[model samples]
Structure formats: structure tokens, C-alpha cells
Target chain A: MTADVAVLGAGMHPWGKWGRSFVEYGTAAAREALADAGVDWCDIGSIVGADTVRGGYPGYVAGATFAKALGWQGARVASVYAACASGAQAISTARAQILSGLADVVLVVGADAAPKGFFRPAGGDRPDDPDWLRFRVLGATNPAYFGLYARRRMAVHGDTLEDFAQVKVKNAAAGALNPLARYRKRVTAEEVAASAVVADPLRLLDICATSDGGAALVLSSVDFARRHGAPDPVRIRAVSTVTPRFPNTVLDLPDIATDSAASVAPPAEPFRASIARAAYEEAGIGPEDLSLAEVYDLSTALELQWYEDLGLCGEGEAAKLLGEGATAPGGRIPVNPSGGLASFGEAVPAQAIAQVCEVTWQLRGVAGERQVAGARVGMTANQGLFGHGSSVIAVR
Target chain B: MSRKRTPVVAGWFTGDGTDGEGEADFRLLGTRCSACASVFFPREDVFCRNPGCPGGELTEVPLSRRGRIWSYTDSRYRPPAPYVSDPELEWQPCTLIAVELEAERMVVLGQGAPGVALADLAVGMEVEAVPGVLNEDTETTWTTWHWRLTGTPGSAEAEADAKGAAGVVA
Candidate 1:
């Protein structure tokens, strides 16, 4: 196994449609994380920020923006953007710096003020961008893709609409207890059924929403954690930022076509499965050892896809696992104990980092009502557009 | 007066027939790498993407006109722009299908033919690409492609014309 980075602190600005600058949310979360870690701002050796696409210039150089807002102590800064996987990439960068002894303590932060309704591409016509082409050519929104996956599950795996609703039901129940979640009211299968259909087979409630939020983490070398008087802290064991292999067969977001597999044969394992496999190999642990997981439930059906991808269940058996209550609280292995994107909606850049924060809280046995009993090992999985794959494994 | 018919993006397909009635020899165009033999849609004009193969010349090639439906869905809500549609008119949901061409072993996404509903489509059902209108303004008509089920009498005529077509639409 590779060297570990101690998660010294985890904090977040409560998720919701709070109209405010992203900088405000990120700064608040940073201060809270520093307070939680009991570390002084001047003492941090480095800072990393996951970039948001809006806000023009500042969004691109987010690290300097957060550092300047937090009163620049002249600490080293790095900014990263990988669409939805930006947060994980930031954490990965910090971990690399700590392992290489570039810095003893590093702070990672991400935040976003998302646009309402459908998230669209930037203004003007750019035919070269796939994201723009999907909308202009076919009018395929994000939910359209989710609906396609959900329908495929129904046809191939016998997954009913009820099964997809159950995922929302379970996650909303857990989210009801999470004060930080935007939609805290427990949702019912009936409510999900009554929701408007944004795309065929997938209701509005089945898909995640866009929201304004922020999440931050304070990380340090294990030796530094001990010196700071925290004898034991949750450790980040693995961060997988893998890309898809050539001839990807599945149709993913922002793409109008799958790679032609006519000449070169496709990979044995698909992209999502390969993402988890890499993390497991690096962390030296299997799905059986996971006490809980925080998977990107962009759509309920997608969450079920992650179940099979993470090796929590066999192929086409995710619905069976969900029906068995194996993925709920106090079950075989709880998935998305933080209510996932189902409860929290999506904060884009902040989400992958927030997933790590949720896993950290669960590992500490401090997740309160949503806590998994005797939680020790937790994993978070998320995928971004343009073939970016993110998954992290943390253990106490 | 008729507005000028134009391909929304250039060179992806043949013909500027935006009327959806019949484009006798319309077909989606893609590029094939000479060395690796990998085919790219939306036409990759640059170097071959296959990491294993040495870069080679990418020549434009006509993609298969017919394929089977891999999956399908419909957009009930108006998608956000650069999709040009009249806000003044009530939104009409359209079916989107991913078709798998056996020859290319690839899935291409396209809007289903006007009036084609989800009820009419099934996994592995055969469909053929045809010309359609994306949007139109006073000065120009944006032309795009649509996927319709094969065996329709209109598609049969297009298939016959495609066999003898030599010149690619500029």
C-alpha cells in the first residue's frame, strides 16, 4: 500500500440554493475546517482548490482566490479542474505533495454556486466541444441520458420503476437526519411516483439537482497529525483518478456517440468497473471490507450501476441487493449514508471532496443518526464528464 | 420565400435536405484511420486516437446508413441552448435513440423521426438515418439527421439511391 495522508479536519457549508458568491461559502468552510483541525492559518504549508467554471477568471485560479479570501499567508497554492471529479483531483494533489514531503500540512477546498434548471454549455456556438454538440444537435439533457440507463436496466435486469424509487426513499430517509442536506424531508415511493417525469422512466426526484454549496478538508502527513496532538485520525488510503480505455462501449454524458470498437477489441471491464478496481488494488482492500460507501447517485439507476461496479453485488443483482435492504442503514453495507446526491443535490466541484468528508465522518463513528454501527472502512465513487473517473477509500 | 438550407455543423452528413420528406442519398459521414482502421464519427480530422497504433492518414468515409436501436429515451423538458427552438411555441418532446451499427460496432445518437414514439421502438429494432430540420430562422435553415425505422417505403427508396451515389455533399 502507498503512504497515507491523515484527514485532520472536514467541514462544509450547508447545501441549498443560497444566493451568494461561491467565495463566501468556500471561505466559511475553510475557516470551519481549520477550527476543527485546531491549526492556525499561517501554519498550513499548502492549499488546493477545486475550480468552478463560472465567475470567469477567479474560477480558473480558485486556489489563489480561496487563499486570498482566507488572508494569504503566502502558502503554496495549486488549483485543479476535472469537471465533477475536481474535488478528488484536488485531494489527490494534496496527497501527492504530502507524500513527496513538499508540505507537511495541506488544505483542500471546493465550492460552487450552480445555475438553476438545466445546466447548459457556455454561450456562443463551438462545434468542436462535445458538450455543446449534444444539446444543439439532439437536445439531449442530462436527464435524457439517465432515462436511457434506467430504461436499459428495466429491459435487461428486470429493474422496475419501483426499484429506482426505493433508492430515493432510502436516501431521503437518511438525508432527513442530515442537517446539512438541502432536502431533509424523508421522501416516499408514492411521492417519487407522483413527481414529474423529466425524462422517460426517470422522475424529477430520481435525478439530482443543481445547488450552491461548499466543502473543505484539512490534510497532513501522519507524523504531522501525531505532532498536532491528534494521536489517531481517519486516513485517506487511495484516490483513483482513472480515465476510460479506448473503445468505451457505454454512451456517457456530453457525448453523442460511443467509440467505434470495430478494429480494436473493447476492454474486458468497462470504465466504471475499472475505476473501482484501481482503488481497491491501491488500497489493498476489497468490497467485503467496506463498512459503508458514498457513491455518486446522479440517478438512482446509476447508483445501482455503482453497486455492481464496486463489486458490492454481482452483475444485474443491484436491485436485488437494494430490495434486500443490504444498501440501507444498519444493513450489510450502507451506501451513501450522507443521503448522496439524492439528498444533497450536486455542488459539482465540491461534491467529490464532500463525499470524502462524509466517509471521514462515518469512519470516525460520529455521523450521528445516519452513522453505520462500528464503521471502519468507507469508499466514495464519482465520475465526471470527459472520461474522468474518481473514487477514494478511507479507513480509521 | 424558402430559407437557405444549411448543415448545422459542416461535413458530418451528406445533403442539405432539411424538409424531412426525403433525402434520396443522405448518409452520416465519418473518418477511418488507414493504419488502425478505427472509424470516428463527427469526423476526427486529426491523428488517430488509438494509443497502440502509429498515426496515419484519416480519410473521410461513409458510415452505414442502417443500424439497430441499442437504447432510447425522450426529453420531456426543453433542453437548454445552443439547441435552437421557438420559445413562443409550446414545447414538444422528441425521442432520442442510440443506434448500434454492426459494421462499425459503434453507437450513434440521433433524434428519432417526427411522430416516432417510444412505443414504436424496441431494443435491436432496425433503423435508418434520414435528413431532417433542426431549426430555422428567416435567413437560414439548420439541417440535421434523424433515425427512422427501416423497411418504411420511403427508406427503401433512399436505400436504392444510396447504392449509386458517388459525389459527397459539399
Candidate 2:
């Protein structure tokens, strides 16, 4: 197993469509995390920033930008971009530095001010970019891909529209309890059914929205945590960042065609499952050990897919598990007690770190209204565009 | 004066025939790895993606025009830019289908034929390729391929009419 890194602090800026700069949101989150960790900015040995493409120049050099905003003490800096998995990649970088003894304390931060309406590719006639090609050739928006998966589930597993709606209902209930969530009001199945359809078989309520938000975490060596007078601390046990095996059969986002399985037999385990398995393997724990999970719910249907991928239930049994209240509050293993992306929408770079933040809070018995009672272990899973895989396991 | 006809992207589709007789001549062009025997749509003229095999030459090959519907969906809202639809016109939802070519063991995405709505599709239904115009103006007609479900009533007649209207033979 990998050496443990203590989560010294976690923080976030409330998610919304606030038309502010990403730097401001990230800086606010960083300060909160630093305060929570009881460590001053000058004490931080290193900083890692999850990169954002929207904020122009500052977004690209997010680490330096945030360091400057926090009054640069000349901390070691690194910036990483892996689409939705950017935050997890940042956390991984910090963990590596701490494990290698390059730094005793590292700060990881991700934040974004999202564009209005559907997320689109960068402007240009560049045909080489797969993202731009998918938009230009097929006009397949992100929701369109979500619709395909939702419909495929219905056809393959007999999942229903109500099943999808129930996901929003469950998550919205949890989000309502999260003070930092953008949309905190409870959502009803009736309200979901009344929502307009964005893509066939998936409605506006079924899909997560785009929002501006930030999430940050302060990570320190286990030795450092003990030295700081904390005998025991919430520790991150694993961070899985694996790429998909060759001949990925699933038609993922931004790709018009699946990798041909003709030449080589496809891997038995699909990409999403591998992401969770890697984390489980590295942490020396299985899905059965998970007290709670935070999955990327880009759409309601996708959440059900994660249940199976994370091995929470058997294939085609996610709908059954949801129907049985097994994934709801007061259930055997509650999932997404932190409101999930359904409540927060997506801030891209901020999301994976936000998941870790939620896991850390739950493990510490400090999640307040959204706390999973006596939560001992938690996991967060997300995948990004291209071939980025992210999953983190935290234990107390 | 005749409006100019052009392929949206060159070398992805077959035929220079403009007559209605060439309706059967339509096919998607792809490439196959000579070493690994992998097939690629939108044609990979580059090296093989199979990590296990040494690099091989990619040869252009016409893909199967028919395949089963792996899954289908439609855009209920207007997509973002670079899609080239006029903003002024009333938005029309477009059906998109993912077809699984059994021989190649791959799935390719394409737009559905005109008037084929979500109600007309099923997960395993068979669909065939047919030439269609994506958009047109006084200057140029953008040519592309559309998938029409096989065995639909009047599908053949409709295909012939669409072919003639687009001024394509096959």
C-alpha cells in the first residue's frame, strides 16, 4: 500500500453561476483551507493548482496565480490539467511530493468560472482536435452522449425514466443540506418529469448544470500531522489515476467511434470499473469497506452506472439498489451524502478535489447535516475527457 | 445556375456520381491496419493503435453500409457553434444514431435520415447508409451521410427521392 498522507484541511467556495474570476474563487478556497489547517501560507512547502482553460492566461498558470494571490512565499509550484480529473491529479501531485519527502506540507486547489450554456470546444477550425471534431462533424453535444448511455441502459437493463428521476430526488435532498451547494432546494420526481428534455431520454433535471465554484485541500505528511499535536488524522489511502486499456468499447465523450476490438481482444474490465478497482487495490480495501461514495453524476443515469462500476452492486442491479433506498440517507451505505455534482453542477477542475473534500469531512465526523453516521471510509470516483481516470479513498 | 455540391470533409465518403442511379454507390471510407487487422472509421491513415503489434500500413477500405443500432438519441436543444446551423431559423431536433458494424466490431455515429424521429428508432434495428445534404445555400451544398432504418415503409422511395433532390446518383 502507498504511504498515507494526512488531510490537514479542506474547503470550498459555494457553487453558483457567479460571474467572478476563477482566481478569486480559488484564492478564497485556499485561504479557508490554510486557516482550517492552522498553517500559514508561508509555512506551505509546495502548491499544486488544477488548471482551467476558461480564465485565459491565469487559468493556465493556476499554481503561480494562486500563489501570488495568497502572497507568494516562493513555494514550490506545479499546475496540472486533465479536464474533469484536474483536481484529483493535483491531489496526486501533492501526495507524491509528500511521500517523496520533497515537502512536508502541500496545498492542492481547483476552481473554475464556467461558461454559460452547453460546454463547447475552443474556437477554431482545427480538425485535429477530437473535441472540436466531434462537435463539428456530428454536432454531438455532451448531453447527447449522456442520452445514449441512458437509452442503452433502458434497453439493456430495463431501467426506466422514473429510476433516473429518483436519482435527482435523492441527490437534491442531500444537496439541500449542503451549505456550499449551488442548488440546495429539494427536488421532487414530479419536478424532474416536468423539466424540459435536453437530449432524448435525458431531461434538463437529469443532467447536471455548469457552475462556477472552487474546492481546495491542505495535505501534509503523516509525521507532520503527529508533530502538529494531532495523534490521529483523516488520511488519504489511495489515489487511482489510470488510463483506459486498449480497445475501449464504450463510446466515451468527445469520441465519435469506439476503439476497434477487432485486432486485440478488449479488456474484460471496463474503464470506470478499473478506476475504482485500482483505488480499492491500492488502499487494500474493497467496495464492501466503503461507508459512502462520491461519484461524478454528470447525469442522473450516469450515477447508476457508477454503482455497478464501483462494484456497489451487481451489473444491472443499480436501479434495484436505488429503489431499495440502499443508496439514500439512513441506508446501509449511503452514496453522495455531499449532494454530488447533481447539486453542485460541474466546475470541472474543482469537482474531483471537491469530492475528496467531502470524503475528508465525512471521515472526520464533521460533515454536519450531510454526515454519514460513524463514517470510517469513503471513496470518490470521476473520469475526464480524453483518457483521464480519477478515484480517491480516504479513511479515518 | 446549378448550386455547387461539396463534401463537408473530403475523403470520408464515396462517389462523384450526381445522378439518381448512384444511390447504391454510397459508402463510408475507412482504413484497416495491415498488421493488426484493426478497422478505423474517419480513416486512420497513420500507424496502428494496438500496443501489442508493431506498426503497420493503413489501407483505405469501404466500411459496411449496414449495421445494427447500438443506441440512439436526439439533441432537443440547439448545439453550440461549429455545427453550422443557422440561428435565425426555428431549431429542428436532429436524431443521432450509433451503429455497430458486426464485421469490424466497431460502432460509428451518424445523423438519422430526414423525418426519422426518436419514435421511429429501436436499439437493435438495422439501418443503412444514404447520402444527404447537411445544409445548403445559393453558393454550395454540404454533402454528408445519413442512416435510414431498413424496412421502413416507403424508405426505398424516400431514399430515391432524397438522392435525386441532392442531385446524387447513388
Candidate 3:
């Protein structure tokens, strides 16, 4: 098993379309995390920032930017960008630093001030970039791909539109309890049906929106945590950052086509499933051991897909599991207890870090009304563009 | 006066071909790996993505004209920039289909023919490739390919439908 790193503190700026710079949100979250950890900025040996593309110049050097915003103290800095999985990458980098004995105390932060409407590629005529080609050639926006998955689920698994709407209803109810969630009011199936269709078979409410948000974590070595007066703290056991095996069959985001399976047989497990499997293997635990899960619910349908991918249920059994209330509050394996993207919308870089924060809070028994009773183990699963895997397994 | 016809992307579609008695031949162009026989759409000219096989030369090949619809959807709102469309014109929702080619064993995505609404398509319906104009101005006409419901290529009904579907770019 990999060495563990104590999660000394976790914090976030409330998720919403708050018009502000990413640096400001990140700094706010970082300060809160520092205060929670009772660790001064000057004592931190390292700072890692999840890069945001929309932040322009400062975003590219996010670690230094956050350092500057927090008052530069000459701490070692690292910046990472893996599309939506930026936060997890940031955490992975910090964990590596701690495990290698390079740093005793590390602060990881991710924040984004997202643009309104569909996320588009940077303006250019470059045909080589897959992101640009998908838009310029097919005009296949992100929702279009989500609609394809939703429709495919309806055909393959006998899922219905009602099943998809129930996901929104359940997550919305959970979000109503989360103070940091942007949409706090519970949503209903009728409201989801009444919403305008952004893409065929997917209404505006069925898909997550773009938002401005931030999340941060203060991590330290186990020895450092004990010395700092917290002998027992929420610890990250595994951070799975794997890539898709060759001949990937699933049509992932921003890709116009899947890799051809003519030359080599595709792997039996899809890319997303392998992501969770890697984490499970590294953490030496299975899905049944998980007290709760926080998955990237980019769309309500996608959440059901993640249920199966995470092995919470068998293939084509996600809807049945949801029907049994297994993924709802007070159920066997509650998901999105902190209100997933369904409630928070998406802040890209900030999202994965926020998932870990939710897991950290739940593992510590301090998640308030949304806390899972007797929670000991929690996991977060997310995938980013260009085949970046982001899943974390945490335990107290 | 004749308007100049240009491809939205060069070498992606066959140049206008006319046989005796004026029949047009159209096909989407792709590449096939010489070593592994793997097919690529939007044509991978440089290297074969198949990791098991050693590097091989990629040669141009014509893709199958017909395939089954694996899944489909439509953009209900105007997609942001890079996709060219006139803002003044009424926004017409365009259907997009992921077609699974049996021989190539790969799914290729494309815009559906105009007048083909969500009501007209099923998950496994068969669609055929056909040449269509994406957009046109006084100076040039951008030509691209569209997927239409499988029917007799030159029948009068198909011709009328193709005319209606032309220029309805995504």
C-alpha cells in the first residue's frame, strides 16, 4: 500500500457564478484551510495549485499565483493542469512531495471563475487539437455527448427519462443541505421536465452549469500531523491518476470518435471503471467498504453511469440501485452527500479538490446534516479530458 | 456566372465526379493502415494508433457510404463560435449522429441531413453518406458530407430531400 498523508484541513469558497478572479477564490479557500489547520503560511514547505485556463496569465502559474496572493514566502511551488481533474492532480503532486520527504506540510488549492454557457475551446483555427476539431467540424458541444450517453443508456439498459430525472431530484435534495452548493433548493421531477432542452433528451436542469468556485486542502505527513496536536486525522490512502488503456471504445468528452479496435482488442473494463479499480486496488478496499462516494455528476445520467463504473452496482443495474434508494441519503452507499455537480454546477479545476474536501469532512464526522452515520471510508471519482483519471480513497 | 466550390477541409471528400449521363459520385475520404488494416476517419496520415503493431504507412481510402446509427442527438441552442452560421438567420436545430461502420469497426460522427428531425430517427436506423454544402457566400461555397436515411441514391424523392437538407450546417 502507498504511504498515507494526513488531511489536516479542508475548505472551499461557496460554489456559484460569482463574478471574480480565480486567484481571489483560491486565496480565500487557502486562508480558510490554513486557519482550520492552525498552521501559518510561513510554516508550509510547499504549495500546489490546480491550473485554470480561463484565468489568463496568472492561471498558467497557479501555484505561484496563489503564493503571491497569500504573500509569497519562498515556499516550493508546483502547478498542474489536467482539465477537470486538475484538483486531484494537485493533491497527487502534494502527496508525492510529502512521501518523498521533500516537504512536511503542503497546501493544495484549486479554483475557477468559469464562463457562462457551454464551455468552448480557446479561439483558434488549429485543426490538430481534438477539442477544436470536435467543435469546428461537428459542432458537438459537451451536452451533445451527454445526450448521446443518456440516449444510449435508454436503449441498452431500458432506462427511462424518469430514471434520469430522479437523479436530479435526489442530488438536489442532498444539495439543499450543503451550504457550499450553489443551488440549495430541492429540485423536482416536474421542474426538470419543464426546463428547456439544451440538447435532445437532456434538459437544462439535467446538466450541470458552469460556475465560479474554489476548494483547498492542508496536507501533512502523519508525523507532522501528530506533532501539530491532531493524532488522528482524515487521511488520503490512495490517489489514482491513471490513463486509458489502448483502443478505448467509449466516446469520451471532446473526442469525435473512439479509437479503432481493429488491430487490438479493447480492454474488457472501460476507462472510467479502470480508474476506480486502480484506486480500489491501491487502497486495498472494495466498493462495499466505502461508506459514501462523491462522483463527478456532470449530468444526471452520467451519475448513474458512474455508479456502475465505480462498481457500486452491476452493469445495467444503476437505475435499479437508485430505485432501491441505495445511492440516496440514509441508504447503504450514499453518493454525492455534499451535493455533486448536479447542485454545485462545475468549476472545472476546483471540482475534484472539492470532492476530496467532501470526503475529508465525511470521514471526520463533521459533514453536518449531510454526514453519513459512522462514516469511516469515503471515495471520490472523476475523469478529465484527454484521458486523465481522478479518484481518491480516504479513511479516518 | 458560377460560384467557386471549396471544401471546408481539403482532401476530406472526393472532388466532384460526373459519369456519363451526369451522375455525381461522392464519398468521404479516410486512411487505412497498411500493416494492421485499421481505419481512421478525419484520416490519421502520420502514425497508426494501434499500439500492438509496429509503425506502418497510412494510405488514403474511401469510407463506407452506409452505416447504422449507434446514437444521435440535436443541438437545441446555437453552439458557440468556430461553427460558422449566420446570426440573422433563424436557428435551425441540426441532428448529429454517431454511425458505426461494420467493416471498419469504428463509430464516426457527422451532421445529419437537413429536414431529418429527432422524430425521423431511431437508434439502429441505417444512414448513408452524401455530399452537402455546409455554407456559402458570394465568393465561395463550403462543401461537406451529410448523413441521410438510406434510400435509392438518385431517386426523385431522395433528390428532393437532399435539396431540402443541403446547407443546413450544424
TM-score of each: 0.96, 0.96, 0.95
Clash pairs, model 1 backbone? none
Alpha carbon lDDT at B88, candidate 2: 91
Local accuracy of candidate 3 as per-residue lDDT tens digits, B1-170: 65677777777778433111112467778888989887777789999877776979999998777788888899999888788789998888999898887777778888988777888887888887777777777887777777787654553346766888543111
- Candidate 3 accuracy as lDDT: 0.89
Candidates 1 and 3 compared by TM-score, better number? 1
Q: Model 1, clash count?
A: 0
Residue by residue across A90-181, what tens digits does model 2's lDDT show?
Answer: 99999999999999999999999999899999998988788997887788999999999999999999999999999999999999999999
Q: What would the per-residue lDDT of candidate 2 be over residues B1-170, giving only the tens digit for each residue?
A: 77777777777888524444375788888888988888887688977778887889999988888888999999988888788898899899999999998887888888998988999999988888888888777898878888888756445545666567532222
DockQ of each candidate's interface versus the true one?
A: 0.74, 0.70, 0.61
TM-score of chain A of each: 0.99, 0.99, 0.99
Candidate 1 similarity to native, TM-score: 0.96
Better of 2 and 3 by DockQ: 2
Runs in model 3 with CA error above 4 Å?
B15-24, B152-170
Give me the runs in candidate 2 sitting further than 4 Å from their true place. Answer: B16-21, B153-170
Best by DockQ: 1
Per-residue lDDT tens digits for candidate 3, residues A327-380, read 999999999998899999999989999999999989989889998999999999
What is the C-alpha lDDT profile of model 1 across B1-170, one tens digit per residue?
87888898899998546545356578899999999999998789998898887989999998999898888989989998998888998999899999999999999999998988888987778898988889889998888999998755467644555676532221
- In candidate 2 chain A, where is summed lDDT lowest over 10 consecutive residues? A128-137
Better of 1 and 3 by DockQ: 1
